[model samples]
Target chain A: METARISTWQFFILALGYLLGTSFFFRIGGLISIAKQDAWMIPLWSGIAGVLLVLIWIKLANYYPGNTIIQICIQVAGKGFGGFIALLYIGYFVHLSALITRNLGDFMKINLMPRTPIVVFHVMFLLVICYAVTKGVETISRSTEFLFPLVTVTFLLIFFIALSEWNWDRFQGMFHMNIWTTMKETRSLIGFPFMEAFVLMMLFPYVKSKNRIKVSFILANVVTALLLSLGVFFTIGVLGVTRASHETYSLFVIVQEMHIGTFFEHLESTIALILLIVIFIKLSISYYCAVSGLCQLFQVNNRSWLSISLILLVSGLSLGFDNILENIVFNREYYFEYMLLFAVIFPLLFLFLTWMKKGKEKRKVVGSQA
Target chain B: MIWFILFIAVALATSIFMMVKQKKSTKEIMLFSTIVLLGFADWISIFLERKFNPNHWIASFIDWISL
Candidate 1:
């Protein structure tokens, strides 16, 4: 038996890790920035696109029952070359961790600390992340199980509070833009957060019961898409296209501008804290995956050491961007392609190669039997 | 700033000490260290940048969609 056993609740909580990070926060801004007033449609279409990507993972998991992508790569390509391909995946995982961690840390700086050096937050955040990883995946899963409810409640509360400010008029001019342009912008939407469902592959192995894995995976994507769609829709409706386009914390701005019981003003700090917690959880999980993937790639018994190195590498990369503008520049031109390359293109190729190898093995077996 | 540097110095020292004393692999330490350090960079940047531009690709999707 595996040393760690995650109950159904824990798996569901763990799945939210997909939603809370780049997808929910940073990526939303990108989509809104592109789709503008028409951004709501992007998520609707992108959600469908996301479902299709998640299906690929489901089919792959079905074909290889009880095996991970790493194991499947070895089975298909054989040891030496298979290991090379696995390394590519490991590299992708690490890059993703760095990207997510950087984004989380970036958000913290913008929201919480006006004076605190970015490095301070980076060290503090990673200390917690490393500790969480060291405790292993089960501990994180259990904590997520508890924290998930609070995260959801916070989101719902914010959504409800901002509802009074909703202007149907803001959504009035939808699709006034050319359809083809909206479609092109939809690519950015599909690429950013929706395609991120591919990360489900790494987590799918841990989901209990073979039959439930695919179903649960699809359900998770649905939940994520719904939440994100609501967030973008509300944020756009309340803030209008102009403010929503450039606003970093658009939802929080909506909340701040919202009037309620007289005592409820200046609630953005609370919102910031809530987002921080969610994003931290996100970074930790991705960091853990990267570390764990590396250990598996090299056959290391201890992952803790790799976790430390990854923190430093990510920090250096994060700092290397100089400022937020530079970071955004890197993310746009470089990270966009990088996301598709890792999450979509590479995984599909792996699936195809595995299928071909399996077919060849069947033919060889039949020949021998004859 | 001094305190911050000192804290990082201490953490780095402890990490090195743990590295040598334990039979742990260098790769593992490197991975963890990169995560912490890079995570810090992210935190600092967000805190520092007040008016962060969300669009990086410089795409005119807003105009495109608005049109």
Candidate 2:
């Protein structure tokens, strides 16, 4: 178990930053291409669903206070099966971190450093992440406290600057797409940043002050969703839905479209800066969770022994997809179902088992007293 | 290709030496070596042009299951 506990505000910032890496860069771009002008609404809807699912995650975490999801699994389920579940959760953390790392790799290779191998970007970033993870979770969460505000402020600035090119006419044919098709196209989102919060259960127990943790989480989710919604709306409005839908990383496209004469052109760096900062925080949290989970399960307190190996493993797994298109297809088509197992299904199943165990304990107590 | 292999070898060697210096238990070192080696094998496969992509397998499974 982690000895260092963070304040509720730190938890809020970590969660907010994690969610705000704004998968919108990859996810909403593709979704807007699907839902067209009305796609911005998807983030809002996903945010609400994400908020409700987070309540379930918290309920499960509170049942075993001070225990991480991995620890909770071992306690609730027998060691053999519980160990499997714990490993699965650890795998989730590693897998998500890898996917995001690959996203950064792809982004860099395409936009900035075309000559450099994609693996180079991943290796450099993972090396930094390995250092952060070994320092422990408190250090990472505290760093997010400042980075969150910085990234959000710059994100707002970028949006405002891009407002020069915004066009209401871009939204002219709003709901021309079939309703059911739009819903199908966007359903995977709730599983994304939201159900993805399912992983945050690992960090919930380490929050020192739990008094307003739920409030902080809910507010953070809502704020991130709204910000991402604005991003979607801005992407469609500025670059037009047709173009943004086809392009990967629509947010970058919007920033590229931002021009205040030649003097203020090529602000790709600003948008990339925002994405990198927030994604770093998100990646750090997941990296920390995975490494620590491995340590606890194997009874090793020295995380440095494991962080480097995990970094190497993730870099290799991240390249498992040959192209970004394959990854996007997985995210859009099957990722929700895959995530559902770890996010909602297993958590709820464990919650039910917890209730049964509690009932049995109460019965034993009554018999003893009688 | 040879240079990239050397980079992997040097990285793995440095990391192992750091852990040994930190006096990590043998069991932990063994676990670390196993994972890092697996990672090394995968990376080498990619560079060797016999790339192995687990995503393709999962995507195909998803398609086959129609899920």
Candidate 3:
């Protein structure tokens, strides 16, 4: 008897926040480094592919309403095998949470505050996450509903503000490069930002409306893609390819230069402050899913009991990276492939079986009618 | 390290207290405590200069297979 407390609207905002969270700030430069001027278009194609990927989850979700990916896994496969698979998913989410925390900690240490111990930022953020998530998933969604509007307004405001520095000449050589080859080179992006939305399957079951759930997520994916693509487009236009590619945060580099008359100079921290909250929303979703899945696996009634432990667990793990370069290197070389099994293979098998089962049921009904 | 230990002790005490107060099953309580203790031990190990780096493990595994 699970009650759905989140509206499709909140679900859309949560998806936007979660998908864009740490990546827009941290991962954009790497994309720029690979594709140069055409980096802007990568997310668009990635968005289309992401839609196809999410469609599988949507169909599975529709087949079994009110049940999470974890529950569905346990149902479709036997308990021992399925439960073990579900546990792996939980562990994956936990690892993702740790990575997101490390991303923020690394960002802050490198760019914002160098002297403070990284653990302070990790623990502080994790503490807030622990508190919010312990209240339950609906609390996370409701808070996302409240704060997402401000993120949007600021996003738009920064967009207009950055437009003043745009130069079209930077895009001069863009059309010469082959599109198919570019896509092949930068395909890892599809995994990092788009396919990774597979994790949202955990949140999909909680959306109050069933029919239009696909629209909410597909629209969010397209919108986030557009926003991110626009971000890359503007970064190249303002800073050019070489400069944008080198900086850790190409968009933040653009923001740092936004000087409206005399008043709003050095807006990097301002943008950082907003984006850090977006990252917080992202971490909370992963944290909630991991905790909820673990609780489900263990049959623990009060999920909050595990919250404190997970904070320590994630924080400790987050500090494992000696610095940002190794983290970036790991992500570039291997993160996507590592995510392949969970994001693609498992869901495909689940949908195939469910479809087969549905077809058999339909055939049985037809025979009875005859 | 002392403060970290104290924080863990207090956290464990309160959570287990609440679990017991809510009349949760002993199995649930044990599982919760075990995870928390595991996490606490992990953190303490980090501060003691003996870190367990999962990224290393994952990366090496990926490399091992790639070869």
Candidate 4:
């Protein structure tokens, strides 16, 4: 049987999917809410934690090279039980995609199209996602590789544009926040977007080279951290600490005020289009992962049908949230911990389980040789 | 409105075709299809619950299922 494989570059895209989507819009409130005036510290702390966790994941992958998380679970925990764990992961992945779709839909509706029905944005986004998944991971990966340069350039351009309006008062008293608040926020910050890159474990089976996976994973986390920092810093500086929390994509508001001259004003729409492109790329990869995990768990012969099914399912999920307020409320209340369980906790647990299994297997081999 | 419904129907139909053509066993296909329908029903209920007051029975049944 032929197994579909993706190149190293695609793996990078898969990681980008996890980082760019969740962090892009929401990282500001998450950072400022915790770090207060010392928002930059949040990224530094989270990056340290993120890199360490990713290294743990890399070490596990090295132990069992070329196996997906589901495959590894089965190897470590035997067929029946491992398959059940894999099924649980499938549900987790599905819930994740639903949350992402719902959030993106909420953001787009509130920010870009107030008059147009929310379903319009939802359908269009999912339709594009469905098309991308049908083409397979390579398409999404290549698209990410292709657009990554533009996205980066646009991101930097926007960051610099906001720099002109920097106000240091928003970042004043950098370390003055109570230590407990900072530490608590630091833990929540670690999970939201940075450590969430742990989801890339599922894609480990597809990449050709197992060597240097750690280097790539750490590099991805660092780059993501820097981007998140840039976004949060600019948001706080431009919007001020108070208003920044209310502005979901506060970076856009800063850009709206920007003008090289009078001719270049009201730039929010252009920025929105670029972000829309980035979000779509992010969504496609994530939706693909959710579908692929399901296919593998069910042992389905072809996964393309899963993509089509997701189109409808995601469309519905996106609309399930009544508005941005409910979405935001749910995210903080339940979604954060829920995501950690599947994306972070389970993978870490599986890593430990795999390590124990390998030790036992090694002992058995040594005994036989003796 | 008609176009929207037709578009969704077409998407579901295409998925069904691809699902069959790919030769996935009926069980898997059915599972996927059921998820799609269930998710769609959940969304539509939220979309039209109060506006279509006459359909309270349908809404109540969906609520009972509790997605």
lDDT of 2 by residue, A25-71 (tens): 77767878778899888888889888888888878877888788888
Chain A TM-score relative to the true structure, per candidate:
0.92, 0.96, 0.94, 0.91
iRMSD for every model: 7.9, 1.6, 1.2, 7.9
Q: Name the top lDDT candidate.
A: 3
- Candidate 1, residue A345: Cα displacement in angstroms equals 2.3
Clashing pairs in 2: none
- Over A118-216, each residue of candidate 4 has an lDDT whose tens digit, in order, gives 778777878888888878777777787777777678777877777777887777766687766676645656766765565677777667776756767
Q: Residue by residue across A1-370, what tens digits does model 3's lDDT show?
A: 2344788998998998988766678767888888887788888888888888888888888888878889889988869988989998998888899989988888788779999999999999999999988888788888888888888788788888888888889888785567888777777787788878988888876788878789999998888788788777878888899998899887788888789999879888888788778887999999998888887777777777778778878888888777788888878877777877888889888888888888999999999999
- In the range A197-229, model 1's lDDT, one tens digit per residue, is 565566556666667766666676677777788
Cα-lDDT of candidate 2: 0.83
The TM-score between candidate 1 and the true structure equals 0.83
The lDDT values for all models are 0.67, 0.83, 0.84, 0.70
lDDT value, residue A357 of candidate 1? 78
Candidate 1, CAPRI quality class derived from DockQ: incorrect
Docking quality tier of candidate 3?
medium
Q: Which of the two, 3 or 4, has more TM-score?
A: 3
lDDT over C-alpha atoms for residue A65 of model 4: 84
Model 3, range B15-67, lDDT digits (tens) per residue? 88988898999978887887787788778878888887777888898889889
My TM-score estimates for the predictions, one after another, are 0.83, 0.93, 0.93, 0.86
Model 2, runs deviating above 4 Å? B1-21, B60-67
